[model samples]
Target: MIAGDPAATGRPGLLGSVWPFWVLFSAIYLMLRWPFVATGRFIDPDDELRLVQMRDLLAGQSWFDLHQYRIDPPGGVVMHWSRLVDAPLAAVQLLLRPLLGPALAEQIATVIVPLGTFAVILFLLSRLAARLVDRDLAGYCAVIAGVSFPLASQVLPTRIDHHGWQIAAALAALLGLVDRAPRRGGALAGLSIAVGMAISLELLPIAALFGAVLLLQALRGAEGRERIGAFLLAVWAGSVTAFALTRGTDLTNYCDAVSPVYLAAMTIVCAAGSSTAVFPRLTMPAYLLILAASGGLALAAIAAINPQCLAGPFSSLDPLLGTLWYDRVAEGRPLFTMNGVLVTQWLVPPLMGLGAALVLWRRASGADRALWLDYALVLAGTVLLGVVVTRSMALAAAFAAVPVAWLVRDAAQNLPKRRGIGQWAMSLAVPVLAIMPALPAQFALTGVEALSAAPAKATAGAQPRAGNAPLQAQDLAAIGNLPRATIFATFDIGPTLLRTTHHSVVATGHHRGAVPMRDVMVAFIADPAAARHIVVRHKARYVILAPDLPEISNYREFAPRGLAVRLADGEIPDWLVPVPSATTARVKTFAVRY
Candidate 1:
């Protein structure tokens, strides 16, 4: 039997113990996340544009011509061959759209894919935590914490981005590494990092932090040499794979920019560090020397790349403080909501560690303490790196969850054993209590929705009756069947467009690339002249406006100069431009020139 395999015990079956975990996880996640996913709740002003890029990729747009709908703002978010998650979503939708049809495929990809991935990762985290705590009770707690943590709730459903896969990848790597199965652990870690890099570069620092912690553990004890060696080798292999996968036409450009010099330096540092595990007597000296030399080199490299790395926190302190305090507010979102409770997530790891510390305080073996400490350090380093740029909080949270699970598992194991009614009640109460913190927020948002009946009615009154169908499956099917078109649409509409239609959008909520598209989107919302110019420049065939939604501001001045089609339940408006199909210039004036 594979070590730590629950099946080895000849237990009833995986499902007997697993079903309750899933039920609890699903209940909490659905309650908090369902509305966002169902309503296609995309609020970040850039959602529709990124969907355009995804749509084009599904339509067989060339990798070289990755930029679709050319009027995209300069340096706009582009999904450059980052096939880690996008490939599967696009391929599944494409295959199913042709067979089962666009509507079904879209629904499946949006609802099923995100939820299914979350389930798998939560299961693994629970199992891994069970191993650390050596009991089933702790496993249950870890699973609950994994699924119910506020940070996990926010990111798992509402933000249907590639970060989900990255989290799963990191969890898998930790499972392998924590178990001390070097080759397997190393391989998983490497592959996870590579996949993370492909999905989003934001994960690199977190991966590095994880690697450093593992390396430190390997340097400290007798078994350190082999473990460290395995980790370093795994990291190198993963990097090579990631580079191979992502570097196509950009190979030369990336090669020129990514120094072989730095690569070699890293390899040397890794080799020396890995070597210390073999020579225990020489471990401390070798480690200190290696640390000093490597630290010096890293400092030099940082100076070379961006002297800002060495700049005492004060140098870039203003941006950090502004970001922590006011920048999110400046963007017209609550500081708590802008990035989905990023600051709050930081507190989770420590809480988890405290729980673990309580359980392990006197009971844990020396080796286990070392393991936990290593992970704690790694988590801390990851947070620091992630905080440097708030966009990385999702990845940071991914790292944080592991320790939290470990600690929660340990705490649960320490709980006094009970029987019968007490046991059953306790079992039910644990998950409920774990998820209670999330209830207030979910209830508040839903409560706000309830209290806003006046605005809802006002919106209903103002909208065209025909657009009120809530973007049905049939409308999506019809749009998907049409020739690929550039569209003007709201952010909420972008993912559905990517999932169902053959059209490219001007934006999506992915803020990374929305920097360029923001100005155009604002113009579309607040200025009619600019909107007209943008429509002409992109050769947009259709402009979709949701009248009942406050997003009506986004399409306000876009006076339709062409065929306007009011589809059924006309709460939405679809305006068609009658200009020649290929016209690339603005219609400065529609009045007759004669």
Candidate 2:
């Protein structure tokens, strides 16, 4: 580093150390995310709902009541989300609302909260990258984190969902894995997983993988035993506290979220694991016996608390819903099942990262080799997990960032010594492809297709997407003027409808609303009379069809004579009276004439 480099010394204060990352990340992210910030648009339905969740919390909804009362009316669906996620968002909104007024405050909250999360992720990754390679590459790590689509997408502006938090927790776990202090590292890994699990049980698999890695280390010696023991104790302690504070008096053991059942299971693991550290350094065989018995004991406790959970959350999902809705969620599906181009884009960064990990492991020696080997195994396992569950790829991408950065640095530093132009080009291409695997390929393919389709494009007139913007905007304005009432709508429209107006929706794409979602899906695919009966059953006063009505195309196809198709064709049933149009609002709103 140069003598006067502020970032290199990190001398000013806490923020000074990470200010370079913050400024770099913000500059890159804001330019890229300017469109969403300008329009106050949310990237995902989940983010819209997260805003609703934050609003409710700030509006004085009980902390323990995780119900979206607007979702199913009288008997609302109980959300599996924890209050921990809602806290920071509410705080931000509360802080800004008085100054900017309610509307502007909300828009700012969405942007600020996620951008804050983005900065944290970069700082953590840069520190990890610095340890793995060089402190000089910390800025490079920040740049890559902001520019990398997989990592950036999770925490970009208006992305208030918990996915970013989960990624941060996973990085914390990775740091814990490599930390020198056995107890602190284990505690960091354990508590971070606990927090992640409290937010979403998606972390369950990560917790298991981490637990296994820690357990394997325990077999080596006493330092290893302390690490494993601290992990179990910390997880057990952390999960218990989170459950009590968040769940309150709600005692019904839920399979979908962390409940007493999980805490009980943790108790068994903690007690057994802690014993290994208390006693004299035991034989590997002794540790094996204890671990085996602990698993059995935990399973037995789970059976006592809620045996049904053993089958997992999706076990009880209605078969029809699974076929129509759950099966079609692209992000939730395996990598191979996704579009080839999309799969390649997501696979490249992490695969390159794993390759780097293998290189780092091979080149290292002594304890460093063992550390890199551990990193390699975890990275490889996470990559495999991402292959099976595609959204997990984001976490894998974040994990891969350090090694990928290190690899890029190694290549760049060796560039001056290279003999050929071909070598120079290859070295240059490594970082480009590493950061954006799909863009070049996508651009090339798009260019080829554009040339081939030029005549068709010239004849077809225009695309609907640009046209959709104003129609959706005007519909939101119109709906916002109406009286608050429950509206029966398609799955994708539910979240935004709730956000933009003082309206309630029967259901959204959220799985916790499974029962109501089932009824809604059935109505969409049923005969007009049947659909009317279902709509009236929910006590909904209106039905909204999004501009494209693209969300329920499955309903239109599965039942050709279904309500979704009838509505799309302007074949309104007698029971539905057309709401007055402010403009040619393609997202049709129908008032139920019950």
Which candidate ranks first by lDDT, i.e. highest? 2
Deviation in Å, model 2, residue 319 alpha carbon: 1.3
lDDT string, candidate 1, 1-594, tens digits: 012343322333433455566566656666776665675544332333334455566778765444544334333344433654556566667778977886567545665556666666656566554545433543454464455443464334434566567677766766656655555566566666656655655455666677676667656665655565666666666655655555444442221122233344456555655555566676466667875686577557556655653553224433422332224332223324443233443434434544443445345556566655655565566555545554444444555554455444433554556557767566544334343433545566678778875653565346344332345555565556556666655544555666555566666544423433454354344334445565656455566544443334223323222111121123222223322332212111011111
Model 2 agreement with the true structure over 1-594: per-residue lDDT tens digits: 111122332433434445777776777777887887787676678888888887888888998988998898977878888888888888887888889988888888877888888877877776675555556666667666766777788888888899999999888888788765789889988888888898899989999999888877776677778988888888899888888889998988888888888888889989999888888567788888998899999999988878889999888899988988898887788999976678778899889989988888888775567667777778888889999998999888888887887778778888898888999999888887787788877888888887777564454566555332322567688877778899998887788888878889999998888889999999988898999999999999988876465565777668878898888778889999988762244677888997
lDDT of each: 0.50, 0.81
The residue ranges of model 2 lying beyond 4 angstroms of the native Cα positions read 1-18, 454-471, 582-584
| Model 1 TM-score, 2 decimals | 0.64
Q: Candidate 1, which segments miss by more than 4 Å at Cα?
A: 1-16, 23-55, 62-66, 69-77, 90-99, 138-160, 181-187, 252-283, 291-353, 379-433, 438-594
With a 3 Å backbone cut-off (N, CA, C), the pairs that clash in candidate 2 are none
